[model samples]
Target: MYTTVELVRGSSKLADEKAMSAADVEMYIKKAQARIDARLKKRYRVPLAEPVPDIIESIATDFAAGFAIEKYYSQRPGKEEPYLAEVLIKRAEADLAEVLEEHLLDGLPGVEFLPPPGPAPAVLARPAMQSTTPVRSEMTAALERW
Candidate 1:
């Protein structure tokens, strides 16, 4: 996983472990990593191998934390300020979109970009026939008979 449960806890507003269970946090992190992989697979080989890029880790943390807070938090009735969760998710998504559209992973180590899969070349599927029998015209047939 790009981000860990600890990182998600640190990045989010969950002050006490009581607020959100460790298993829930871990689940969020895994989901966040999967989401990242889905988004990045079009450009790079994903689940991203080991020693993942720092930016990717950060984005995953943000996503996981946001998801946890947005889903599990119980006090959304009268809060006036925007939830940190929303901000984190929006920023992470924007960054991820930029990474996808702008070729941001071009020079990073361990990052493999996939060439766009396109249509197959227009070519005959079968081999050319060799030693074909010559077409015999009516005149040629008559001559042959003669």
Candidate 2:
């Protein structure tokens, strides 16, 4: 049995590391939901009061985590950095999905599953030379005119 701390810690680590892909993130979400469902199924054994909040909360947490990871990686030096950031984002996404699944499995009404968000685009992919080229050319032209 996976402890909540294990799940949260793993998820956070993955997000911070950005080591996951878009598809992997989606799969993580699904797996989390399944885990939550199985747990609730065993625990409640009856319908829930309302599942929508749980679902929404779960999704929100994942999105928030994704955003945070993306923001962090945006400031990093290169695209070649290990994909730890991606992993962290996926973990967040999974957490959200799991919460939703738990509520739904509890028999709460009006619960809906949300799709996992896409991975953050590669910011470090920008050519390092692109920005420098224009400035270099401008300086050269200026020097020629001088």
User: Tens digit of lDDT per residue, candidate 1, span 28-140?
Assistant: 99888888889988778776767788888889999999888887664577432237778989988998888788887777888877777877665655567664567757886
Q: How many clashes in each candidate?
A: 0, 17
lDDT of 2 by residue, 91-112 (tens): 6456645654554444345433
> What residue runs in model 2 are displaced by over 4 Å at the alpha carbon?
1-52, 78-84, 92-106, 109-146
- In candidate 1, which residue ranges exceed 4 Å CA deviation? 74-76, 80-82, 115-146
**What are the models' TM-scores?**
0.73, 0.27
Best by lDDT: 1
Among residues 3 or more apart in sequence or in different chains, the pairs in candidate 1 whose N, CA or C atoms overlap within 3 Å are none
lDDT value, candidate 2, whole model: 0.46
